[model samples]
Target: MTLSVRSRPSALAMVSALVLSLAACGGTTKESVRTQAPAPAASGAASASANPDAPIKEGLKLAFLPKQINNPYETIVDEAGIEAAKEFKAEAKEVGPSDASASSQVSYINTLAQQGQDAILIAANDPNAVCGPLRQARSKGIKVVAYDSDTSKDCRDIFINQASSEDVGRSQVRLLSELIGGEGEIAILSATANATNQNTWIEFMQDELKKPEHAKMKLVKIAYGDDDDQKSFQQTQGLLQAYPNLKGIISPTTVGVSAAARYISGSKYKGKVTLTGLGTPNQMRKFVKDGTVSKFALWNPKDLGYLASYAAAALVSGQISGGEGEKFTAGKLGERTIGAGGEIILGPPFTFDKSNIDEYDF
Candidate 1:
């Protein structure tokens, strides 16, 4: 069921029948009779009633708010979401702060709410800092969808997770262990300290390192780059200087990984220290070709945004109400089911290296 870039369009034909079949099911159809009472609204669940048969509303206004406007990875994700809006005849636009600070996005959230957007897709920089504004938006009947990064469970209707948090965290540790021969001092160059996604993944990496197989590996320090290029470059230098015996480094953010690679490429640590984490193919290609990096991993950013857009539309159209076991068609990505905690995982991440890096464009 893994999707490659070339195979996504072909899946539409295969899933079209499934969509029709689900719509025709007697008991599940919107027009069917029901004996059970409608479920009470959970803390973060959508308040709107479900209408599974309702067609996607046209000319709906959707707004995407990322952590910052300049991050290339977020740019790709937001662009894909905007494209998806076009497919369903919705008007979508991207807006956000220039800096990824804890409260930088507050003003934008307030503005989007005031503008009466039907839905707002956000990647929260700080989970709690934006909770108040998110609540205000939800009070206005705006559908809130968190993607890439997340807010607390009670703050959003749905979270479009790129992959399982546990899988992403543990995989980074395993990849680094294999590269550094299973033993030595290592460090994590992360994004902001309060970033929900980064902190969650780092916690899993720490838990994975406690296993007996990784006993020889020591995670000495975790330095925050705040997702800034110059800061990440400096932090990489600091990590190497602070732990001269460091064998590897893992940076789970795209900005941090690329910055770390640039620093390692021209420094003495290029061949001695191994670097691995989540990164886009195009951004890491030059480093991989020059032998500065051996391997890294990430899911398709375009698909992440595309799926998020559809999920938001489903919420607005009342196709589902952010409840567990609810299902909706994500256009070409096919039918997606909501899991516990209002989460929809895109899929497992794909690893990249010199062997197959050339095969991907983003």
Candidate 2:
């Protein structure tokens, strides 16, 4: 997580990257920033190709939805699915709102159901709020899978998690605890307070903090930035000003973590402070490159969405259901199942640093 992220302000690099990617992709930057409506029923635009060697069944119309459209994490995951679809011969298209909002996603969910999609995979905007509609979609024979963030278990047939939430939290706590030498003050710059995965990870971190070795890493403040870089940057500054001796910061939000790292890197506290959290490799690379951040964590979102799409396609093709013991192939991703508490881990998180940063472009 030793990523040397920067800011004139912070983490706008992601937005900059988005702008550049969209421009290269042949769309106006403004339109590309939002997850537009699904392209007129696939339009037969070579969206469904043949997969001679793939394990997928043909003629599937699958929908992939993250909390928001056009986001770096969502964009990568969507692109990965596009590549997988070319190989698997399934009809995969991503759709979601311009911003991460429960109301917006709820409306989009309604549209997907109306579109008669074979399966729908989602990173829900709100857990409890979206459950009812998801359950209703299921009653209509649409396969429902939760990707990055989840809807409640009862509302979802399966949760395609990027990594174990507990694992993510524990990784951060262990790394941060080590950075602080097991003792000192710390804080959390979380995403929206209600985000299920973030909340679960933070709860796990709280429980971990009770461990004897972590007794010195006093978690001083907890703040929310709504995943906005500006807000996160402001909160980071606030934390520094409010808690002058704050030893470290664990920002479980991708945006929050990067913002904190950027602030810590350029501020007078550069070497004296430590920061870590869930962040993208591309977003965190420069930060790590400069030693602004020691280490941070996140399951690869591209892989997360790739697997989620495959799982949804499997359900559409009748390969498997969320039965007590059912295994399915996510193509190159290997086999996975609904484990205890209905969990589905994509894989373990990779810790980013100098040695491997260059290998990853996103």
lDDT of 1 at 6: 36
List model 1 lDDT by residue over 1-362, tens digit each. Answer: 12233345444343323211110000111222222322232343443467767889998788999999888889889899989998999988889988899999999988887777788899999999998888888877778899999998777888999888998999999999999999999999999999999999999999999999999999999999999989999999999998999999999999999999999999999899999988988899999999999999888788888999999999888898888777889898888988888888887777788867665576
Clashing residue pairs, candidate 1?
Answer: none
Model 1 spans > 4 angstroms off = 1-48
CA lDDT scores, all candidates in order:
0.84, 0.70
**lDDT per residue, candidate 2, 1-362, as tens digits?**
11233433233344323211110011111111212232211111222322223456676667777766756666777767656766678777778877665566887777777666677788777798887677667766777888778888777767777777777788789988888888888999987777788888889899999998787778888898767777889999999999989888888777788888888888898888888887887889889989988777665566666777777776656555555455677776676665654456776666666665565556
Q: Identify the leading candidate in terms of TM-score.
A: 1
Task: Predict model 2's lDDT versus the native.
Answer: 0.70
N/CA/C clash count, model 2: 14
